[model samples]
Target chain A: MAEAVIEAKGLVKKYGELEAVRGIDLQVAPGEIFGFLGPNGAGKSTTISMLCTLLSPTAGTARVAGIDVVHDPARVRQKIGLVFQDPSLDDQLTGRENLEFHAFIYSVPAEVRRARIDQMLELLQLTDRASSQVRTYSGGMKRRLEIARGMLHEPQILFLDEPTLGLDPQTRRNIWTHLNDLRSRTGITIFMTTHYMDEAEYCDRIAIIDRGQIVALGTPDQLKAMVGGDVVTMTSTQLDAAAEEIEKSFRVTPTRVDGTLRMEVPDGKKFVPRLVRELTVPVDTISLRRPSLDDVFLKLTGRAIRDEEAGDRDRMRQMASRWMGRRR
Target chain B: MSVETATKPMAADLTIPVDTRAASLRAIYIIWYRDILRYWRDRWRLVASLAQPLLFLIVFGSGLSSSLGSGTLFGARGGLSYIQFMYPGIIGMSILFTAIFGAMSIVWDREFGFLKEVLVAPIDRWAVAVGKALGGTTQAMIQGLILLVLAPFVGVKLSVLTVLAIIPLAAVLAFGLASFGVMLASMMKSLQGFQVVMNFLMMPMFFLSGALFPLTGLPGWMTVLTRLDPASYGIDPLRRVVLSDSGLSSAVVDRLGLTINGHVLPIPLEVGVMLAFGVVLLGIAVVMFQRRD
Candidate 1:
């Protein structure tokens, strides 16, 4: 097995009385793509902040790239590269200038820095627009430039906090391609977080965090398997009656949420037809699909990952982005 | 995707040793260089910075000079012009504004998330604090120098010796103000908060610094406020040196210069007080930045 590049033992972070991250214990092997999959306000960002040595853990301990994050944060910072969820590029500077400044501050050797800057620009396919100020770049280009800057120093472990958040699907795919290319070429350990379930499918392993705690951890398939089998979701005006009828007729347990009845079956496609025909109560809608990260979250937490209760997290994300915007 | 085989050679690549002191110095240099580069790129800022100080020198000075007449204004000679006395004060105001606003870049950086970029780097946080302080100081001093070019027009005599003397004096004032600005900005969470606080603090400090008038004839309570103001110490020595070669009579010069309890504060001691303020504030800024980050 590869050595763990990042390891934590019950790490916790508190902002006064609010516990943002609570007892998150995990490990990432060197050169693996590790994803902290969670919805907003699930403590994903707070965990990344602690591991990246930006915020000290209020309790417990963490080691990134073999250095204790608290005992020696500088060493951890040296070994890790962080691509913030919020864009950290100086909009006033050109793409090349931004990379050059990062190179200098990271103390990359002068001779090596010049070559690395060119190499990064080319690798990220940003050579053509490298001379333009960052404010002129499109959102995708700006994100690519930020990633390029983060990788310029060749850090052993890279922490990306929702690298593709708020991006369109096409742009998100482009960023993923770039990230995959970089990972293939450098073999650096990539640690990232995202609320998007499909994005987590690309990770070698994932930890599902919610409400400041890790509820599940495994490869995507393993997590899905934990949900037992395929999922059938049905909605009816009388969800309780529909659920009771489906359970009694199909010999499968069903959970009622809102006006919907959800159940895991051996084969959702095979079972959905029977469920609709045999249900005594009229069904408004019925759908069947493979168990996903969302299903895994539902099974574990008894609530949809992106439930309406996420208003606080949405507000917090907005505040953070607005604060970041106001600085410029 | 077990990557152990792919990671073996990476161990060799990651171990490139670095000299800690040299790396720390390099970080400071890069931060300082980045600041100067940004300032250079913003031509409008440089131009706009001159407007307020010049307005004070031309509009305010001219308006007050006509009203007060050519008699002693601050204790200078009977012939010493109001424009001349206000020249050093105007320069002092320029330095104060430039330095304080220059440090405001921190608040901007924080809001923009650029502060996180710098803070997350491996270098010492103190290096960042000191580099920023020096960057603001250098820019502020340059603004003062630009204002100095108008010295002859204002009837303040200038020679090579006096010009050379003004450099250190202006630098002391700039550094002190820059450090104070950084200290205040370090504790600020938002640019709006910083602006509100600056608006509250700046006018009083500039007014109490005795920049527009002499410190000698202020009321008892105002005298204490002036003495407590660090800019007061900075402005007094700057006025004394810049006007010493203005050909003012000794009696009028004595009358116009800064005095406390019937004793004139020596130039070196005043410079020392400003230096102390600069160092102490800079130390505080470093502490605040380190703690916050």
Candidate 2:
């Protein structure tokens, strides 16, 4: 087994009256891609902030590249590169200048800086746009430039916070391909926080966090096995009542998702016949599929991955209270 | 076959880590250089800073020149033209104004998150502060030099040697004031608060510095207040340097029998005082920066 290059124990961060991160422990091994999977406001950014030395943890300890983050952040920063959720490059500078500026800050030697800049431009396919101002680049190009800049100093570990958050699916896939190639070529450990299940699938292992706590941590296969059954989905004109009847007849949990009835069962194919007969309403369409990461999150959290209402309401109230306090 | 092929490519790809301190300093130089480059590129900003002092020199100095012609008025030495005397004061005033307003860039950086990026870098915190101070002081120094070059055009005679001496003095004052400006920028936290402090503190300091009028023209209390003002101290020695041929001994015996050099000496007390102020303000700014959110 590879040794862990990044480790955290009982890491906690508080923002006055609120506890943003609550005693989360994490370990990321060398040459491994570790994903922090969480919904918005699940303290993923907060944890990354403390680990990256952007914010001082309120309590607990984290070590990146064997250096304690709180006690020796400067050393930790020297070893770990960070690409924040927002692109931090200066719009006034060209892509090459941005990388050069970061290389200088990391104290990269001139010859190496030039070589690395050339290599990264080729790697990111940005040679043509290297001299173009960042503000002129497309979103994907900017993100790729930022990633290249982050790796300019050849840090041992790289932290990418929601790297593909707002990108289109095609762009996200393209970035993922570049990221995978980078890891395989350089053997650099990558720590990423993302809400997208497909993004998490690209990681070797992932930690599912909710409410400032890691609910589960394992490989995607292991996590999918945790749900313990094939997901049987049915589409009916009256999904609500049919789902209710199907749940009553079988000892399976049926969840109403987007005009469809989804239930997990060990023998979905075998149970389909019984389900159709037992259902009071007619099923227009029925299908059995393998469990996905969304199903795993739903099974673990007892709510769908995209539970917009509860999360949005909580976020709105938090924002409103913050606004009121600021006014006061 | 595999071993030889792989080894060659891997060796070519492998890179040794190089020392980065020199690069960091170079980056800081670039940052400072960029500030000057930007100032030159933005002709309007240059024009505004230069025009402000030139207007004061042209209108105020000319208006007061005839009244105080070549004489010992208000304890000034005899044979000094009012334009020559007022020129250094205006230069000092320009330095103070430029230094203080240079801090507005910090506020802009914070709002735009450029400051955050700089803070997150592996460089030393003191380097960030010092780099910013150097950038601001460089801008102010350039403006001061521009005013000096334009001195003859404004009816003030200044030798090249005096101009050379005035550069370092203006730099010291600019850095000192810029350090204070940084402290204010870090403490205020908001643009509105900074604007209020700039108007309240900076404007009063300039007016009370005797940059516009001779310190002796004011009442006894006002003169005492001017003595306590750092800007007043700054302008005194600079004025004496520019108007040195007027037979004025830079040192004066105060009422308390204390001998003080206003500007005649090679190194003026104003430079020392401003240096001390810069150190104190820089110390405070560093502390404030560490504690910033």
Candidate 3:
């Protein structure tokens, strides 16, 4: 097995009474694409911040690239590249200028700085637009440029926070392709967070966090396997009656969720035909499908991953209190 | 396999460079360079910042000089033009405005997310504060130098010695004001919020620093306020250096010099206080940033 480039043991971050990231442990191996999957306010970003040394953990310890983040943050910073959740590019600067400035900050050798920047620009397919101001680029181009800038210093590990947050499907796919290419070429460890389950499919391993704690951890297939079978879902006018009939006939308990009868079976396709024929209550619709990350998340957290603005106020309140805590 | 072969050699030797003193200095230089690049690119900003100060110098100076000239302000028995006195204050005003606005860009950077990029870099947090202070100080000093070209027209002395003295003197004041700007901007998250607070404090600080009026013959309350203002020291020395060598009477020079409890502030003391203020304010800014994300 490859060695772990990132290790966190019982890491915790609390703001007043709110534990944004409760005790959690993580170990990401070198060259592994590790995914942190969670819904909004699930402490994904907070964990990233602690690992990146942008925020101090209230308790526990973390090491990035074999350096303790809190003890030697500068060294960790040198070893890792971070692309923040927000757009951190200087809009006033051209792509090349931004990379040049970043290279200077990282103390890349003067002899190789120019060639390295050129190589990064070419790798990101931004060689032509390298001279154009970032303000004029499309969102995808800007994202690609930011990734390029992050990689300019040749860090051993790269942390990307919501790498594909607000891009189109094509751009998102392009980004994943670029990330995959970079991984294959450089073998640099990648730790990224995203609410998008589809994006998590690209990871070698996934950890599902919810309400500041990890609820599940494994590869995409392993996570789905934990659901144990295909998901058979049925909507009926008499959902309670249907659920009882399914349990009686199939000897499997069916969960009633939001006016639907849902059950996990070894072979949902075969069971659906039997279920339709055997059910006593009038079933309106029935469907059988493979378990997805969304279903895994739903089963674990009892909720679907949604783009929620309702939690924004709560998150802001948590941030304000965190800022106040830092002052002390 | 072909792609890995092409890139692996370059990526394989990932050197973990320690963050030494030289790296910190390099960080400062890079950050300073970025600020300078932005300033140079936005030529309109430099032009626009000069407009308000020029208005104060030309329109306000001429308007006030006509009314206040014959009144023996600062004990000018030989009828020294009020513009000569107002020129130094205008220079101070330019420094205050440029320095504060330069500092306000920090709020803009924070809002735009660039501040986070700098904060997360491997360098010392103090480097960011120091680089920002130097950037703003340099920008404000440039504005002051531009304004100095108009000094002769306003009846202030313009000699080799005077020019040599004013540049560093203005730079010292610029450093103090810029450091003050960085301190206030460090706590702010939004440009609108920073602007609101800056406007509230800036106008009062300029007015109370004896930049627009003589400190002598003031009421006890105003005297206390002026004496307490650090900008007062900055402005006094600048005004003294010009007036003392402008062939003004010793009596008039004594009246124009800044005094606290009837003792005049020496030029060296004034410069020293400004330098100390710069250092302390920068220290506070660095501490504040170290605590922030």
Candidate with the greatest TM-score versus the true structure: 1
User: Which 10 successive residues of model 1 chain B have the least lDDT summed?
Assistant: B69-78
Task: Give the poorly placed runs of model 1, Cα more than 4 Å off.
Answer: A14-20, A235-241, A273-285, A307-312, A317-328, B1-18, B70-77, B192-196
**In what order do the candidates fall by DockQ, top score first?**
3, 1, 2
Candidate 3 accuracy as TM-score = 0.89
Q: For all candidates, state DockQ relative to the true structure.
A: 0.43, 0.30, 0.52
lDDT of 3 by residue, A29-69 (tens): 99999999998778999999999988899999998887898
| Interface RMSD per candidate | 4.1, 4.5, 3.2
Give the alpha carbon lDDT tens digit for every residue of B147-182 in model 3.
Answer: 877777777777889889988899999999999989
- The alpha-carbon lDDT assigned to residue B126 of candidate 1 equals 86
Q: Which whole-number lDDT from 0 to 100 does residue A157 have in model 1?
A: 91
- Residue-level lDDT tens digits of model 1 in B1-293: 23653767665534546677887788778777888888888999999988988888889989988788434463233777778888999899999988888876888888787888898888878888888888889888999889888987898888899889999999999999999888988878786686576667888899989799888877899989888999998888788888889777767767776778889888899999999999999999898877774
DockQ comparison, 2 vs 3, better candidate: 3
Per-model lDDT? 0.85, 0.77, 0.85
Q: Mind giving the per-residue lDDT tens digits that candidate 2 earns over A1-328?
A: 5668889999998878888888999899999999999787889988998899888888898888878888877778878878877667776677898787777777877678799999999998999999887789988998899899888888899899988866889999999999999999999999999888878999999999988889999999999998767999899888777867776778777887778888889877888888878778998999988898898888888767663453475467555643452232
Report backbone clashes per prediction.
5, 1, 0
